[model samples]
Target: MKRRIAILGATGSVGRSTLDLVERSPARFEVVALTARGNVEGLADAAMRTGAKLAVIADEARYDELRDRLEGSGCRAAAGAEGLVEAASGDADWVMAAIVGCAGLVPTMAAIEAGKTVALANKEALVTAGALMMDAAARSGATLLPVDSEHNAIFQCLAGSRREDVSRLVLTASGGPFLGSSLEQMSEATPDQAVAHPRWSMGAKISVDSATLMNKGLELIEAHHLFALPSERIDVVVHPQSVVHSLVEFVDGSMLAQLGSADMRIPIAYTLAWPERMATPSQRLSLTEIGRLDFEAPDLERFPALRLAREALERGEGAAIVLNGANEIAVQAFLEGRIGFCDISRTVERALGEIDASRPRSVEEVVALDGETRDRTSALIAESRP
Candidate 1:
């Protein structure tokens, strides 16, 4: 039997990798739906090539262009938030939620509500509404598979072990491009330099988060939700080699780790063939060729975003939501040259302090609070500008 698949952010790095694997093993999978934010060309091409039943464009203004592009492709076209929800909740058995930022929250929730097996690449969904999303998964009997390399590694390590025997999870970070740079150098870092990740190729927003070590922090919150753990039980270490994806320690002093080449397809393939392993075109790991593996503690003073994320995780869901919302805006500002690289964490810190930390009981409330935080953070940025 073939597994039905849907990709929410088909134009992204992870999404493209998934499509590559699916394209290679055509007999094992079928792409039922494909969506992109505004890349009509890529979306249309993927939809047509995969023979997907539906192609959705999240940007309503590009609906006509998308529709025209898919006119003779035998794939139906839809646009905007409603279309994204439709794509997520369709007949696909495996849905890849890879849309960046808070915009992915609703559709991701929709997939969970529909009881679909979700490959979650969108960290914001778990970061902002961990409790709510987990509760929905529990109620609907939906399986939430972590696609981030760190969380996926932890998931694999705990596969045959008892959850009670686990002591802590160690998530490894590449430390981005500024791993060794001083605080002064980081503050003066350019957007290009920040996005120039030494290990992996990624989109701009995620690259910035990696540069500031906030990506690791967001994964910490995500691990808490996925693994039923607390902030204190999780640890972050700087592993410049990117070989050891993550580690899990047991109460008996036994530590298990998942090591692999720096490839998104490895994790994507794991989720795609759950309870079964699939072959991917990822590079094979050679410890001999790449001799020494180094590790160190993350310098909080140099990258305060990780510290801020840890603080937010300890404070609860509301603080996490504010942290993610504020960071998203700040990262965008830095990318557009409206703010400095170091100012990204500074902006998130200020928003966390100023925003009401009241916990949202529902998804609607979460969206409202996220919007409010983004607005306040934007104004705060504007006010600070000369």
Candidate 2:
């Protein structure tokens, strides 16, 4: 039977890549639904191509346009966050939780609650509510699959292995465009420079996160929850090659690594066909042609986001939520030329320091803390400006 898939954030980079795979072999999969925040044109186009049964626009203002576009196409159109959530969990065997940032959490939770296999591309869900999500998965019998390249790689390497035999999980980083730049060099960097990631193509926020090493930091926290590993057992290595997605060190003095060309489709396909493997339109790695790979320790003095992330993961008192919210705001400000690139980490640090450091008893508490931190971080940015 063909798998019925609902792709959230169908207009974004990861979403588009997934669509490419589905379109390549329509006989193997069916797109039950497609959703976008406000890009009705892209959403409608995707729905039409995939012959999706439903199209959703998270922005209510675009509902009419989306509806009109899909009117005679036999696809239904809906709007708002509730619509997005409904489309995510309605009539689908698998849900690609690709909606970027924290906005994706609720519907992603809904998908799990509805017992759909979730292909999680949104890192914030795990970073902010990994424990809750894991618990929900266990209770609801939902299969939570990793779609992020690093986490997916780690998952592949650790497949069929006993959890107790694992020693540590090492996530690889391309180190972004400012890999070897000094603190002075990064302090005056522009958003354009920061978003020019060295290896992978990603969105502005994630690209900026990569430059500050905060993406890796956030992934570290996500890894802690996803792999059930502690902060002490997880490590980040700056691998300029990015070919080695992630590694798992076994207690038996052996390290297992997953390597491939730097492409999101590979991991995306892996999740789409979990417990099985499928071919993707990704380039195969030519080890002889590449010739070499280099690894180095991240610099704490230059990229304090990594350290702050470690502290947040270790503390686990809504600290990760604060760090993520502050970083998102600061990155948006930096991208708009409102702040220097270096200020991103500084803003996150300040926001983390200002938060009450209270342990969240629920996901609602996490959102409350996230909102408070974002408000304060936005105010700080405004106050700092001339």
Superposed on all Cα atoms, the candidates' RMSDs to the truth, in angstroms, are: 0.6, 0.9
Residue ranges of candidate 1 with Cα displaced over 4 Å:
none
Measured by lDDT, the strongest candidate is: 1
- Give candidate 1's error at residue 351 in angstroms: 0.5
lDDT of 2: 0.91
Report the Cα lDDT for candidate 1: 0.96
Query: In candidate 1, what are the lDDT values of residues 302-322, reduced to their tens digit?
Result: 889999999999999999999
Q: List, in order, the clash count of every candidate structure.
A: 0, 0
lDDT of 2 by residue, 188-233 (tens): 8988899888899987778899999999999999899889999999
Deviation from native of the Cα of residue 363 in model 2, angstroms = 2.5
In candidate 2, clashing pairs total 0
Colliding pairs, model 2: none
For model 1, which pairs clash? none
